[model samples]
Target: MEKVINETDDKIKQYNVCVSYFDTLQECSFSCCFPVNVKPPVIVSADILKFPRTEYICGENFALDGIEAKVCFSDNEFLLYNYGENEGLFSSDVTTLNKTGNNEVEIKIRNKYNNDGFKYILTVIVKENRLVSIDIGKNNEGDVYFRLGKQYTDKVFFDHFSVTKHFEYNKGMTHDIKNNVVFNFEKLQYLGNGSFTGVLYARYTENEKTYYGEYVCDASGNNRIILLTPLPVSLTTEKAESVNISNLAQKLKSANITYKVRYQDNTELTFTGDVFNNNTYSCNGVTYTINCNKNSIWLDWKADKMDCKETSLEAGKLYIEDFWYYGEEDLIKSVDFKNEKTLIFESENIIPEDLSSYFSATVEYITGCKITINGNQLNKSIDKENKLITVSYNGLKFQHSFSYSYSSNGD
Candidate 1:
């Protein structure tokens, strides 16, 4: 028998044994030495060979490929590589899952002999990107309606859907989805005059995967065409007796006045012209007011008809019967002295103690009489060649003419 073994390094290794015996008489040999203990491989378990799929959606494009890890090693067990196709050994600090809900993803592995590293958390949920909700109704001949589903729940239906015009999605006009609503839907060509926004795009299937939501719909339809019957909050003209304060606007344009209206379905329209010519008239949006009366003039025109006596015609009075005036300078209609009627002052102590701030005026009162510039004086410098500045009003008076002169190269 003979045995010998040696060749191993990591510390301790030696083995030699020889034992020989040849039949009965001469021939003997015996040797023994033993020791073999070379360590350097002890990592019994590393985990994860297949386990990575914890729900994902929001912008999903994640990749940790088949996710593999095994490792073992006390004497071999390998299976790494697939951190999404070779990440040296295997690694991941998240490679695209785009945050939505819980999303951890650590996953690492390395032991290229002894670098030793292994971790694995990987939570990943990420959902968001669902948007299917739109519902706005109104139908009883009043049109406008839409519907879609799922968000706060309305039961949800739709194996396929499509609607457009939130901005014309891509080219405009689309529509599909029948029982799930979408009736009438006017607003003409959409864009807003009051409502209607659109854009649905849905699809279905829940746990079998195949979603596609996206709904908007705001300002739901109705550009005004819902009158099943209702338009008469008030309308009823016709009344104009005697009117003639000097032909009150040609007798209210020959007085045609009619109006009528009445609708809740009993239907009856009528709106004659010159409806009192502007004593106020509007119809659908209600305005009316023209029950005229005026007639009885005579401010003065005595041909001796008992010295003139008719009077009742004053609602915005203007009954002139031969008048004449040229007095208070015709009530003065122009006088705008907003400063400078002649002012030259090179600092006479910076003159202007408040001569009404250099005499102001601006009066333009005619028939609405309001004449101003009440009194502003500073005319007391009689010796330095009269430097007046008076202003007064009502009994009218004006004068500004200043002069100070005191230059020292501050020109």
Candidate 2:
């Protein structure tokens, strides 16, 4: 009897055979049954002879080297999966170690016949390479700034620079590449005297490889201590009185008003300039208000005067030359005036102190004419409501009704 068995698919099989003799007369036959068992191939042992180095620097390129893998089958047949170098049977999740600290790389190998895979975990210790140094400096504005040292500037390309310590001041530090090629800390206004110590971090590229580095920056000395305070004494000048209106701009350029600023070192620095806005001078982020005395230049000009025609002064026959107030003239123009039917003027509730200034007006007209409020004199009708101010001159009458309120505030 002959039979064929497939070793890969069939594990076991059974067969029966019979033999016959004396074919003509009395036929006798003997039968026997037998079974066959087939052993399937299985992986008995698999191992790696050598692995790549488990340590590397950050951003350093590396590949699998001197790695060899072999597998032993159940039939005692040994197959070389990888020898000397990678034979396309070995693969890894990481080609180069780019992350710092412990980076887990999974190396895998699979048997082609059974589709079984094996994994090896490799922890690569990637250390950071410190290649640059930082130092403290100042800009043209005398503001504290930081930059990479001159010795390393040409060797490395700056990617990002930041302050790692002093989180309160770190938020104010900014990196500007165009005009200011440094980390500017001028916006941190509250930094006081003494040694300012902080960690400076940088990420740069060198020779087509990325690197990270840190530096401890300590800034000291008188120039590093930024202290500014506006002195209590006011600054004034009488130059505005003699200068004409057209030459005021030229006069102000030459006018030098000196002021004192106290620093942390108990030393006062005198700064002289005429750049005053509304009797105020601002320098180094500090604003100082110049107190204008009787002889001061700002008090000589009647800049606070407003024209009566610009306001809601709708009176007939009575001529209003000018109107003056101590505060902003724009506040007077903000009042809503309605000319419908009655020529009424409405205003917000003015405080007690501002009422006297708001009511100041200069009037001119014919003889025997006076300004009255609610049929009484302007000074005596202070407590009356629906106040009406009227001026009558030679039978020509001028009247205006005001609709407004005020808060006395216990006055």
Judging by TM-score against the true structure, name the best candidate: 2
Those runs of model 1 whose alpha carbons end farther than 4 Å from true positions after fitting are: 1-68, 72-74, 77-90, 97-107, 110-250, 253-280, 286-411
Evaluated at residue 377, the lDDT of candidate 1 is 31
Model 2 per-residue lDDT tens digits across residues 208-275: 54444444322443233222221222223323233332322233444543334443234354555456
lDDT of 1 by residue, 135-161 (tens): 232223333223211021222223222
Q: After the best TM-score superposition of candidate 1, give how far the Cα of residue 20 lies from its true spot, in angstroms.
A: 27
- After aligning candidate 2 to the native by TM-score, how far in Å is the CA of 74 from where it should be? 2.1
Candidate 2, number of clashes? 0
Candidate 2 vs. truth: CA RMSD? 18.5
Which ten residues in a row are the worst by lDDT in model 2? 313-322
Worst 10 residues of 1 by lDDT: 299-308
